[model samples]
Structures are given as structure tokens and as C-alpha cells.
Target chain A: MSLTVPTSTTLVELQDVHLSFGSNEVLKGIDLKVNKGDAVSIIGPSGSGKSTILRCINGLLIPQSGKITVGRTRVDELKTETERIALRKRIGIVFQQFNLFPHLTVLENITIAPRKILGISEAEANRHARDLLEKVRLEQKANAYPGQLSGGQQQRVAIARALAMRPELVLFDEVTSALDPETVGEVLAVIRDLVREGMTSILVTHEMRFAEEISDTVVFTENGLIVEHGTPDEIFSKSTNPRINSFVNGLGGRATPLHDGEGI
Target chain B: MSIVLKQERAKQLPFGGIFAAVLGLTVIAWLFLNQSLGQVLLEWLPYLAKGFTMNVLISILAIAIGTLIGIVLGVMELAPFAVVRAPALVYVQIFRNAPHLVLIFAATYIFPFELVIFGNYVPFPDWVKAVVGLAIPASAHIAEITRGAIQSIPTAQWDAAQGLGFSRSQSLRWIILPQCIKRSLPPWMNLYASITMGTALASLVGVHELLHSANDASTAVQRTDFTVVVYLTVLIAFFLFCYPVSRFTQYLERRLASR
Candidate 1:
């Protein structure tokens, strides 16, 4: 349970993090670090605490006992709500449900936080939001309400909304899992482009091929602990751990190919 | 040919016109048959209208104050700590259960006329007392609506807002409250219309609103025969005012639902 002062290159570090929900222990002593501009993918079976890690990182859920650092901010040690909000301002997350405000038009959904929290001028916020919409290939749907758009389109808008803040780090919690099989490609394409643009991200994804293609570090969790941590190649083909091997085999994919099938 | 065109034609149809015509004819026939009653009605219309003005004023001020009180209390009811939530729950329960007329009486008679703050006496006007009385029950109803509407929003929205770096208050203001407004509007309008009708209770406390004005005018005329006309005018005035609120609430409900 030693605390490490994350070096300059490490943008996020979780040291000995422990969290529980009443009788259920969701995360038991998780330690992980992501270097700046690195794409880290956390892949695991359901109930293995992959999403819980992302929630703790985003301050949506606080750890029972641990140290979490993003850049210089000690997230768990933040004393005031304002301080936590300041810390959160530097981070963004896109959820599986594409939680866009249904009552607002897509443009408004993207512009709200920047205009309200950052006190950015309306014109400037709109300009930035439009640029993000362009990136997600959803500029055409900017004026449409979330309900009118297809699931993939809504998820794209959500990604755009997260990007509008210009966050230093982004977390994607199974961003494409809820989409129709055909639509999943478009949403994943958006995330792929963001990774190419060097957005530091921690993605909790079941898309095995996509994760292997983008992740600089791959973490495998089971029973509320990290059972395997390595580069994509090491974790996919080189790791000899029986648990990691069985989990990869359970996905119905050969570890060497990495793109054997859809998802676990 | 087009749906819009069909809807426009539907709007042009005089669906309610026949009913209105029949009702109007019946009232006119009654007036003509009782010529002296018709004359008294004409004489008392303006006096009753003046009292209706007082009702409108009381409703507006009381609703405004009540909504503010409701928003604060509702937020308190959602507070994470028991120290803050317990008192707010108690406040909501007490005010919501007490009858509007009872609150009006309590505010008018039992409450102090003046407060000594820092050794200075601040006098309370009778209108202010009546406003307080009307606001109590209205505030409680609004608080309940606010609490329910806010809770009804999916938890995912809260997580999304938090992920975007919003504090609890900022999330409530920018995200939660906007959605709550849509969900809460119809019931809120219902509460308002009822409160506006509740302004009649202010008459018992002697605030001289619509009913009080009608009572004074009827006494002056000294004819129990014209009593029907006096009370009927007051009833029609209220109907004219409240019917629109109900219609607007329906309109908004449909509009929001389409979203």
C-alpha cells in the first residue's frame, strides 16, 4: 500500500485503491498508472470492477481508501467541492448509455458545460462545439434533439460533448456497447480517431480487436483485482497467467490474432 | 391533402361554439325574463371586477414566494446529511397537511404584527399576512412536486453531469433542474390554479378579494334575489381566469411529451 508520487510522464495513477458497496467488494487494492497520451484499456468479465475503476478515476465514486492522482491533483484528498470540480474539469467521460440531455438539442448538449462551468462566451463555446461535432461526424445532427437521432449518432454527440471541454484525460465506459452491431463501428471509429489525436484515455471496452489496436497498456481484472497487466502483445499472446489465458479463450478468440470475433 | 392542412381545418371547426351558444342564450333569456335582476347585475359587475383584481394580485405574489420557498425546501430535503434533511422534511409535512384556510387564519391572527430585529420594529401589513397564509400550502405542494420530479430523473444523468466536472448545485441548476421543469410544469400549474382559487379563502381573513367584494356589493344592494347574479359573476370570473391555466398546462404537457 505504498504511495508513489506519479512522475511527470504519468498522467493518472491509482495506488492501492479499495472500494466497496456495502457487502460487495467492487475493487480490492487496485494499482495502475497511465502515462500521458497513453490509451489504456481495462478488459474484464462483468462484475470484475472494470467500470468501477473508471468511476473512481472520474470522481463519480470515491474510493474507500486509496490515493488517486491525475497530473498534480490528488483526487481523493480534495477537501472542497470546488477543488474536486476543478479536478474534474480536466477530465471527461462518455458513458455506455450516451447520457445526452434529452431535452436539449445536440448543439446545446455540447455547449452547456463549457458555457456554464468555464464561463466561456456563448459564441466561443458554440464554435468549439461545432468543431467537436465535425470531429465526431455529427455536424448535421447538431440541431436535432437526442431522441430524434439513432443510437450511434447520439453516442457520437456524447463523445463530441466530452471533447468540447478540451479535457486532458477522457474515460470511455463501454461507449459503443449499447449500439446496434452495425452502428458500433461508427462510434468506435470516433474513439479511434480521438486516440490518433493523442487524447489520453482509459477505455473499459469489450471490443477486443479495437482495444488491441489502440491500447498502449491492457489490464485484465478478475475477482476485483488486476490479474494481468502488460502491453497488448504481452497480454494478448505472451502472458502465461492461467486466468488471463482462460479469459482470452473465453472471448472465443485466439490470443495471437486478437481480432478473432465480436466480444465476450 | 397534407396533415397540417387537415389540422388547420380541424381548428376551424366550431366544436365548442354550439355549446357556448346554447349556454349564452339560456343566460340572456334568464336576464330578459328578470329585468330588475339584469339591471342589478350590470350595476354590480364593476365592483366585483375590482375585487377580482385583488385576487390576481394575491395569487401572483403568493405563488412567486411559494415557488422560491419550495425550491429551497426541496433542495434541503435532498441534502446528504440528516441534520439538514430532517427539518426540511418536518417543514414540508406540517405545511402540506394543514388546510389552506387554517394557514390563512393562523397567519392573519396568530402571527405577530411586528418583529424586533436589532431593536428595530418592522411593521407587517395585512396584505403581507394574507400572502404568507396563501403561500404556506402552495409552497408545501410545490416542494413535494420538486422532490418527486428531481428524484424521477435517471441516475445516469447525475453521473454524466458529475463526470463533466459539475458540482452538485451546478448539476442541479444546469442539468437536473431543466429536466425537472419539464416534468414538474403540469403539476406545478395545477398547484398554482388551485392556489389562485384558494385566494377565496383570503376573504374570510378580511382581505377584500373577489368573494369579499361580492359580499359587500350584495349587502349594499340588499336584495337576496340578486344574490345569484352576484355570486355567479364571481364564479364566472374565476372560471375565466383558471380555465386558461388548465389549457396551457395541457399544451405544455403535449409539447414536452413530443420531445
Candidate 2:
């Protein structure tokens, strides 16, 4: 009953990545490195392959030519689906649309993998799932279905669901884009909480303010290329890349600063 | 008021006459079953009941098998991955497009085909052939219903599970299938009832199911009216069997809607 607990560092590294879905190319020879502890935000316009990068990291979509590694395991070289699943156990993803299982209770949704794939006993998984629910301040919603919860509440549950896997790297795909303004802050708060734990997160998001406030590195993507890569200040204030500047400044390069002389 | 009533009357209930027609038919049917009291019960009852029960048996077995297989194929056909879904589509297309009669006959006679292919076969009982025949065709219809129900589930749901690191199979097992099964149940049960009624096809293969027994009794008694009573009994029995499931399905539908 002893699974070799992998104590490896060097989480995810993507080198010369290129992917094409028919005539449409998504990832174009992209190179990126995510270390053991890093909070990076990937920001870009629609159709600019921000999400595709996350998918490639998890092996949901394989790049045509890339040398990718996750943990001690090589990504492109994983021979079987079982291997990929085993690897993804270390990599958790929070979708843009919170996909808390509608049919299952919040607790059940969080603990399914622990119970099934990890071979953890149901009682143990439930105990752990309860803790995850508590982390999101949704302990009361442990038994409730996803339908009973609001969009923000559901997203929190999704975050809890991902953390239940206790992954080294968590990917957030525009976690607040689908939510109302009132709800956006709540979801962002949960991500901030994760940052407190030093959980490595790669967030594909449009919330420039949140990105600027929290991320260690912010990459501005345009037409399947990384136009600018730097700290939040570097990107917002001192970015030389015109495409990155225009994208961040919205209204075509009108830098709508968040506060007076406080553009972080 | 009269003009409004005239306009509303058209839409009030177009099928009101249907009740009257059914009542009239029932009276005629009762006369056939109720004629000669003890004699009617003695000669007609056993034979009609026996055939009716056999038909029920065949329908139950066939529908049960069809339902299980349909659920599996249905989930497969709805898979997002082309690798998993393509084979399922091929199976669905083959079965769904083939005539029900052809499937039934082929399943009934499949042992011989199995023998020809493998150069060996098990000696199947007559009941097995009839029941398998009915089930094979019924499954095709059931698979189509299951596929539709699975498809009606939102794509966001599948993606959500995918994002959770659930493999294609795991997502289906834990998330998609459960919802699909619940949604598919009402229509599935309805199909079950229909297949039960259709088990009369056993009579074609010289099986003494309900309809077969009824025909036998009609020929023996030299009374054509017994056939009416046999059919009436069948309709009532079916109504008895199916009404509760239909009600349950409706209740479930309403409950899901409220959610």
C-alpha cells in the first residue's frame, strides 16, 4: 500500500513547442520554464493560445514537436494514458467554467480521484475532502450539489476539488472571467490564499489587476507568440512590445492606470 | 362568452373522443372475455394468460439486456475523443440502420452463424433464440435514446471533468454517465414497456407466448371472438405494468426540472 512519493523538483519545462490543429496552429515554438515554486500568469486576447499552453503542459493536447517535462517524468515521452494520468495527479487544473460535478456532492466531487485512482479509502478521502471544503470556507457546502451553489461558490468548490489532489502545480484558466464582478473578488481571494501556501500556479487570466498584484512573472501573448515577458510593473509600465502594451492598456494603448502613480 | 368558448373548444381537448372510443371498445372486449362465465374462464383464461405471461417474460429479458448494452454503447458514442467514440458510432450505425426484424431473426439464428465461424456452438434452448432476437432489435432503439440523452448534457460538463485530471473513462464513470443514466431512465423505461409488448413476435417462431397461446385457444374453441378477449387482456395487463413506470418517469422529469 506504499506508493513511491515522488520528491522531485523542476515542475514543468516547455521547449520549442509547436502544435497545429489541422491548418490552424495554436502553439508556435513556445519555450517556457516553470520551476518548483513560481506563480506565473499568462495573459492574452481571445484565439491567442493562452489556454492551449496550459493544455499542452497537462498533455490534454500534445504539441507536434516539443520537449516537455513535468516533475521527474518527461511529458512527450510518456507512453501510455495511465502514465499521463499518473503524472497529472501532480498537476491540477481549474477550468474557466467551474466544472464541479453536478450530480455528485461537493465532497464526492473532490474525493473521487483519491478514492478511485489513488486507492485511498473512502473514509480517508472524505476526511481529506472535508478539509479542502474548509479551506474554501465551503465546509457547509460539502454535501450540496453544484447546481445549488452560485457561480463564484462553484468556482471555489472547483479550486477545492483541484487542491484535494494536492498537486505541485495548479493551472487556473481565467477562473474569474465567467463570474460577475461581485463574485470575481471571492475567486481571486481563493487564488491569493493558494499563493500564501507557495503553491506554483500558472493562471491564464484577463484580470490584469490580479495578475499585476500577485504573479511573479506575467507573459503577454499575441497571435500564438509571447510578445513580452517580465514582472507586472515591467509589463504594464516599461513594456517595449507594442502588442503587449495595447493588450494590457485596453482601448488600444490607453493605459488606464488602476491608481495614481501606482501602476503595479 | 359563447364565441370565446367556441374558440377555446377547438383547443380544449382534441382527444376527448379517444376516451369514448376506448370505452366502446372495452365493452365489446369484456363481452368476449366474460361470455359463458365458467366456460370462458376455463378455456380462454389459461391459454391467453400463459401466452401473455411468456410475451411479458421475453420482453423483460430482452429489454433488460438491451438497456444495459445500450447504456455502454451510448456513452461510448458520446465520447469527445475520436479514438473512443468512432468505434461506438460504427456499432450504433450498423444496429440502428438494420431492420429490427432482421436483427431479431439474426440473433435468434446467431448460434448457427457462431458455429459456422468458430466451428463449434452451444445448443441454445428455443426460448433463448426468441428472447435474444427480440432484445437485439430493442437494444438498437435503446442505444439511440441513450446517445441522445448523453449528448443533451452540456459540453462544459465534460471539459470541467477533463480539467480535473479525470481520464476520458474516469470522467464518464464519475461525472457524465451518472447524469446521462438519470436523464435516460424515463425514455429507457418507456422503451422497456414497448419491448415487453413487442415480445408477441415470439409467436412467429412457434413459441407459446401470450399471443401464441391465444391463437391456439381461438383455433381450438372454434370461436374467433376469443382473440378479442386475448388482445383485451394483453392491453389491460400492459396498462397495469407500464402505468406506474410512466408515472415515475414523469415525476422524475418534474423533480429534475425543479432542480
Candidate 3:
């Protein structure tokens, strides 16, 4: 499929991004540009630091060195916790664990960040929360506690909670990895529906077929680095990199069994 | 294997065992070995009853002060920077290391002349001084318990709240502290019960609590049996005040654990 950006301008740019957890580097001098209204799927193995990339954008983990700009805010330069927090409200993150506030009902979880941080009145926050819940087809479950819901339902609630903040950019850090195969489609469908409506998204995912369906670009990661980037056709169909060919084949890509030195 | 299992489950007995046993044995031993339960209960029923009210007033005041001080010191201990955490450790060490009775005695005798003097005068009653004395020492251990509870929550929670744009104080006020209070409630309630029972030691310094009232009445009656009876009444008073709060603590613990 031909790629199209869902946004009017570039929403995120990572230049020489380097991060470490005391001496173990997770992101090594990565550089990338994602225009606004774009849907990019980052695919990689379990420990490839795909999730770390999403976390760094919102200041959940600070990069030791380099520059990451999310719209107008510089990710590394936001020094105080307060400054980092102020920058986070503009970026919504959906987690793999579906981190809904288990102590609160679905509606309460969604409206909490908006009502507390943005100072939206209860009536106003309620209206927006209800609208987002409706979008995710979870309006009926508004009164339910997170523990009462199925994994798929919890994920949908998580999406509504993030959207209630009305973020300029949404990050999905392998959000469906923890779900059962039967439940994955429902969440993927919600995300696809959001993409259809022009929401800028950067998704860390392993679903190759799904990336082919909705992504404007497919980024392949390995050893804490972005190894390749192209349209799904170029990366999946006509790749010259032996590593890319081996990696895509291991994912059971297209069933042609492209032979190489690293055969499965 | 069975012995290992027994050891695993053994961390002192539950409310059904040692803790409750201490409460029960103290009452029964006070009654039968020393005096008749009903007769003793009736003897200082007035002074013991009035003293029971006074003891309760001190418990409420101590628990409130303990919890507030615990939160402040607990947060200071958990602060990310070393500047705040280092001094907090000294505070916890000093209080936890010292005997509560010694601190209470010192507060009553020394603090008036040292800290609260205006031209060498303290504008307070003895009872207020005693309450402050009990609360300060009790709070030191409370601060340590509170810090451990706060630390046990996943740092992801703090990160999540911050990612949602909450200020550090706001994140704590909204999320972290509520969970800590819920998590710490059982031990905290036990701590409150402990120091309220410790108030009997206040009688040694003249606080007029249940045991003190019993001492006064027994001396007035000139009977050791009367002292036994008064002490049993004090036991009853402690149980009456502590049971509801203990039950509430259990209810909250189960709810939080399930979450």
C-alpha cells in the first residue's frame, strides 16, 4: 500500500538518541523523523528496546545523550519533574499491560488525568470521557471496575483513558502483546479505526500483516537499533539485507521460505 | 516438610493467636489470679470508665499525629535526592533506636524547659505534654513502617502518574499516599493499639489513665484486689477501642490486596 501521513506536519524527530540504564545502552544514537498524522509500526524481538523508544518520548526514561523533539517540546531538556510532566499531557501512551487504574471505575480512570491536570470541570470531563468511551464501544462498561472487565475490554478502556487527554501524539508500546489471540483483533480494530480518523500514532508491534494493512512506514529494530525502514512492500517483499530477509522469514512472512545463510 | 510449612506461616500468630492471647490472658490473669472480674470491674467502674475516655482521647490524638508525621518523614525518606533521604534516615534511626517510655519521660521533663520555654515557661497542661510525648516516639517507628509501604508500590505508578502530567506532590497526593495508607493500615493500627496500651506506662509518670485511675482507687480502698479489678477494666477499655479499628484495617487490607 502507498503511505500517507495522517497529520499536517512532522510530529516527532529523534536525532542521535542515546539512552542507558547505568552502562547498559538501550538506544544507541538513533535518528528518525515521523511527520504528524503518520502511523508507523516498529517491529522487533522481545528485548530489542522497541518499548524503550516509546517510553523515552514521554520522559518516562530520560535519554543520557541526544535530542528528541515531540512537537514543540525538547524531550531531553525538560529538566524538572514538573516540566517533564507538563510535556507528557500532550502525548498519550497505551501500555502492553492495559494499565487502567484498578481502584477506579472505567469512567473515573479516563477522566482523572484530564480533570486533575487540565482542571476541566467534572461536567466537561464527563462529556469528553463519555465520547471517547463511545468511540471504543465501551460506553456500557463505564461503571465497571477494571478488574471486572476482560483483557480486551480493559485495553479498550485504556485507549479511552489516553484519548480523554486529547493528545497530539499517541504511542502504543506493543499494546496487544499480552492479549490472547482471540482478543487481539478487537483491540487492533479499535486502533485501526482511530488511524482511519487521522490520529497520529507510533506503534511498537509484532504483527506483520497488520503493519502491511495500516502503517505508513515499517521500522525494523534489532540490538537496540533501527535496522531498516521502508514501506511494507519494500521491507517485506524485496529486501536485500540478509538480516532483514532472515528476520522477516522467521516471522513466517509470505511463506516463500527465502533461503539464506541463517535458515530457520 | 511440615515443619518447614509451619515455619513459613509463622510470623507471630494472627489475631486468633498470640496477639489476641496477650489481650485475653492479661485480662483473665488479672481477674482470677488477682481479683474477681465482675467485682473488680464494678469497683473502679467510675474512675476506670472516666480514665478510659481520657485514654481514648490520647489514642485519637496520637494516631492522627503519628500518621501525619509518618507521612512527612516517610516521603522524606523516599525522596529521590540524597539531601532529603540522608537526614530522614537519621530521624528514623534516632527514634526507633530509643525506648518510647524513655522518650516520653524525657519529653515531659526536659522538653518544657528546652524547646517550649518563653522566659523559662511552657503554656500547656501536663496531659497535653504527655500526649505529645507519646505521639513523638510512636511516630518514629510509624515513619519507618510508612516508608516501607510507600517503597513497596511499583515505581511504575509514580512514572505513570508523572506521565499523565501530575506534579510530584500531586502524584503523591492523588495516587501514592492513598495506596500507602491502605497498605500500611494493618501495622499502623497495630502501632496505634501498641502505644495506646503503652499509655499505661504513662501512669508511672502520672497521666491518670485507666491503670493510674485504678492505682488511685485501689490506694483509696487499701486493697490489692481493687487494683486487680481496676487493671482488668483497663484491659476491657483497650479491647473496646481497638477491635473496630483492627477490623476496619483488615477490611481495607483485603480490598487493597485483591486489587
All candidates' TM-scores?
0.88, 0.81, 0.86
Error of 1 at A48 (Å): 0.6
lDDT (10s digit) by residue, model 1, range A1-264:
001222339989999999999989999999999988788999989999999999888777888999999999898898777887888889999999999998899999999999999999999999999899998898888899999999999999999889888899999998877987778878888887888777888999888777777788899998889988999889888989887777776664643343234332
Q: Comparing candidate 2 with candidate 3, which one achieves the higher TM-score?
A: 3
lDDT for A145 (candidate 2)? 82
Candidate 1 wrongly placed segments (more than 4 Å): A1-8, A241-246, A249-264, B1-25, B111-125
Quote fnat for model 2: 0.47
lDDT of 2 by residue, B1-259 (tens): 3355346445534443464458557756567667663356466776677677777777788888987887777777766689988887887777767765565667666655333336756566666777777676667777788888777889888676666567887877777778876677666876777777667666776778876776776677665555565566666656665656655765675566433
Number of the candidate with higher TM-score, 1 or 2: 1
lDDT of 2: 0.75
List, for all models, the DockQ compared with the true complex: 0.63, 0.41, 0.45
**Tens-place lDDT digits, model 2, residues A41-143:** 8988999899999988887778889899887778888888777777788889998888677778888889987777678899999999998888888999888
Query: Cα lDDT for residue B132, model 3?
Result: 80
Give the per-prediction TM-score of chain B: 0.86, 0.76, 0.79
- What TM value does the first chain of each candidate achieve? 0.92, 0.90, 0.92
In candidate 3, what are the lDDT values of residues A1-264, reduced to their tens digit?
223432457789888888888888889887777877778889877788888998988888889888999988898898887787877899888888887776678998889898888999999999999999899998898898888999989999988888988998889988887887667777888898888777888899876777767888888888789898988788888889888877777775542243121111
Of the two candidates 1 and 3, the one with more favorable TM-score, higher being better, is 1
Q: Residue pairs in steric clash, candidate 2?
A: B51-B209, B51-B210, B52-B210
Q: TM-score of candidate 1 restricted to chain B?
A: 0.86
Candidate 2 Cα misplacement greater than 4 A, ranges: A1-10, A240-246, A251-264, B1-25, B28-39, B42-47, B72-124, B148-156, B220-227, B256-259
